[model samples]
Target chain A: MHILIIGAAGMVGRKLTAKLLTTGHLGGTPIQRMDLVDVIPPHEPQSEIDIHCEAADLSTPHTAPALIARRPDVIFHLAAIVSGEAEADFDKGYRINLDGTRALFEAIRHTQSYCPRVVFASSIAVVGAPLPYPIPDDFHCTPLTSYGTQKAICELLLADYTRRGILDGVGLRLPTICIRPGAPNKAASGFFSGILREPLVGKDAVLPVPDTIRHWHASPRSAVGFMLHAASMDTAAIGPRRNLSMPGVSATVAEQIEALRRIAGDTAVKLIRRVPDPAITAMCEGWAPGFEASRARALGFRAESDFTQIIKAHIEDELEGVQ
Target chain B: MHILIIGAAGMVGRKLTAKLLTTGHLGGTPIQRMDLVDVIPPHEPQSEIDIHCEAADLSTPHTAPALIARRPDVIFHLAAIVSGEAEADFDKGYRINLDGTRALFEAIRHTQSYCPRVVFASSIAVVGAPLPYPIPDDFHCTPLTSYGTQKAICELLLADYTRRGILDGVGLRLPTICIRPGAPNKAASGFFSGILREPLVGKDAVLPVPDTIRHWHASPRSAVGFMLHAASMDTAAIGPRRNLSMPGVSATVAEQIEALRRIAGDTAVKLIRRVPDPAITAMCEGWAPGFEASRARALGFRAESDFTQIIKAHIEDELEGVQ
Candidate 1:
């Protein structure tokens, strides 16, 4: 099976590539070749699988068909401008996130007669704040941020493209991937994990919001799981609209801290420091608290049960390198 | 005050133009100048108001800003490929519905010191199939048709553009306008009014679906009311996202028959012939049975209370020329 991973330089893309290579199969289909593309080509993964890396910028008019020439069977499109970047720079955001993504879809559509199964990496940012209760699978998307707006726009394009039979696609709206590896990043959600991940290694981390502030999350392992399952599924069941809200664990900052304490003792808990930033707090206020991904579960997609398991998954999967 | 009307040759456009000219002011703003453009030139409205009519197909490139040059205080953009034609032609649907709309938006954004209240005539097709019982104001949009997808996509663009301060816009998802003035039309919903209108004039009409079919509806008067109100309202109350699901009456097809029974007696009923089409039945099955337009109502926008009011509206408003 030939599998393609767009945005292979990003965190999830690199990890997914490494994970797919070792597994050899996704949902039982054996992986023989892996195609990777990004503005910056991905590094080599030490594995038995054949890997082809290409440097391409999708926002450019001509890059689509060039990437589509590989003729991969399954494609995981994880390329996107991060939320902060997209929100701060409107032109760059829509150009890369929206147009670039559309170009990729158009490229895949014109590639040969056979359509590949596309696993699009959508985000919870697609569903922003001022929500009603726990957002169900059927809630209206009222995005407040530029990033959210861009993502929501892409979701519509994906749905319409799939409806037109241009591609067999499934978009996974991933929750904030908690306990993100390597260090506290610049993401708005960085603090949430920072308060947990940094403290585990006895490093001081800031808390931008009150402990009561809640949000939904999934582990990186679950993200890979979502891509794998989306690749394997029969899209006929999804009908014309192909995107799915991936399952997530809802918790506040305190709940996240409690999970850290439970798993790794007081050493992990001591690293958390309270330093509130009103800017971040105000920004997060409009975001939806949680999601009820009943449809995804019904379709056999899964996620960690709660924060503790999410932390457990991270430790077992990510912290092994540290040890 | 300057007013621009896109798609000025369409049925609603003609009616709106005639109505505007007869009443020279919208909410007391004198219609000093009226600029209109469509694939064909608009009919000359019989009034003292200055009417500048232009014939230009919006699908062609670089024509959007040419309309914007007039720089009207209010712009009523009612242009789009109709449902039947849009479904029949794929490329044409995306071209006009999506790209053309985007171009118009971009055109307005590039205007020098240009800011106008954009009154967008969206449709109930934006929300299709598998609705909640008496669908709430915030119900999700799962459009089953390409026409619905296009309108929904434009709504997002409107919201995003509004957020970026490019334009002050209001997208009214008008319920299927009943008593649509004109001869037999191609729209599926046209049959609803056709069966009633043609029969009232002693002509036979086909009722394709069973009398059990229920749909959301508003009169042409209500639709006109929505645009006028949208043009004048304090869009700040609407915040960044300016589109609203305009209030509408939900009634069964049998109720339509009963309303006919109440007014014009059995003569109106005798003109109707029942025929079943499985295609329409399957199509209607997924349609939203009803909608709860709380936001629009909360903002003082009102649609007809019932089908009786809808029929009465048609008689009072449309019958102006007949007598």
Candidate 2:
């Protein structure tokens, strides 16, 4: 099977690449050739499969047509500007997220007599404030951010293109990846992972919002699993509604702290500092607290049931199980 | 107030123009100037207000900017390729429906210190089959047609732009305009108007779907009222969710025929021929039957409560009070 992975330089992209390489096959088909693309060149891993890594900006006019020339059997589109940046730069956000995605879809349509499976990484950001406690799978998307708007628009395009038989597409609206294996960043939602990731590693982390603040989450491993399943699963079941809200564990900030304490001892819990920033607090109120992702669950996608398993996954995958 | 009508040649646009000229004011403000634009030059009307008619295509790069240069106080964006044509030509549909709308939004954003109320014409096509009998305001859009997909995308852009303070915008998901005053067209939804219109005019009309087939509708005058209300209403009440399903009468084809018979007698009803086209029947099955437009109702947008009122409005407006 020939495969193409866009945004391969990002964290989830890198991890997904590692998992695919370890298996050396997908859906029982041997990986003969794979192309990894991003704005920056992706790391070349040691593998028996024929692999090529290239740096390409998809928003550029000619880039999409050039990428589709090889006609990969399966395409994973994960490239996008993060929420904060997209909100800050409107023109740049639409150019990369919206125009770039359309260019890729159009290129595939222009190809003669070729149909490939396209797995898109959508986000829960598609829905915004006044959301239900357990937002149902069929709830409307009234996104408040430019980033979410871009994702929602792309989801519509994905379904329309699939309906027209130009491509077979599936969009997975991934929850916030918790216990993210990296240094804490300044993103508004960073605290969700920081309070857990830093304390587990015997370092201090700031908690910007109240312990009562709840949100949906999944481990980095589970996210990659969703991507693989989306790429290989029977798409006929998806029908015209190609986008889906993925199943994940819903936990409050306090619950996340307790999970860290259970796994890494009392010292980890003490490392968390409660220095609330009202700006971030107000922002958190608008984030999706949870989702009733029953459709994805019934379709064979799975995730951790609680925060404990999520932390354990992070420990095993990122920390070599030292904790 | 200076107003711009993007689709001044369309039936709704022309009616709206006539209504504005008759009233000579909007939202308690005196009318000063008006600009009418379409793909072809709109018919010039005899009016006391300064009126300019021009031919323009919004999808062209410079067209939107040139139009925005004048900075009309209220802009009615009613231009689009109809559903049948959009489905037949993919490239043309996206270019005009999606790209054209985006271009206009961008133009308004680029204008310095300029913010105008933009009333966009969306459609019930945004939502498709498997719909609840009374589709709620929060129901997700899963459009089955290319035209619906484009409208849904534009609705997203309208909300995003409004939230960013780029422009004050309102998108009305207009129901099918019944008794549309025009020549019989090949549009699949044409039968909804044809059965009532041709019969009232002492002519024969064909009904392609079963009498039990239900759909949402409003008269042309009601549609014009919706545009006016959207343009003049206090948008602060709309919050971030700028798109709304406008209120309309929901009736089955049998109900419509009964209303026709009460007004035009058995002879007019006899003109109705039922010859079911399986293809059209399948298509109509995916159309929206009803909507719970509670939000638009609360915002003071009103429509006919029954099919009889719809037919009466058509007779009074289109037929000059002739029965």
Most accurate candidate by DockQ: 2
TM-score of each: 0.97, 0.99
Worst 10 residues of 2 chain B by lDDT: B179-188
- Per prediction, fnat is 0.67, 0.97
- TM-score for candidate 2, residues paired by index: 0.99
Q: Mind giving the per-residue lDDT tens digits that candidate 1 earns over B50-69?
A: 88888877768878878887
**Candidate that would win on lDDT:** 2
Task: Tell me the deviation in Å of residue A315 in model 1.
Answer: 2.0
User: What C-alpha lDDT do the candidate models reach, one value each?
Assistant: 0.82, 0.95
Which stretches of candidate 1 lie above 4 Å from their native place? A321-323, B321-323
Determine which window of 10 residues in candidate 1 chain B has minimal summed lDDT: B314-323
> Deviation in angstroms for A277 in model 2?
1.1
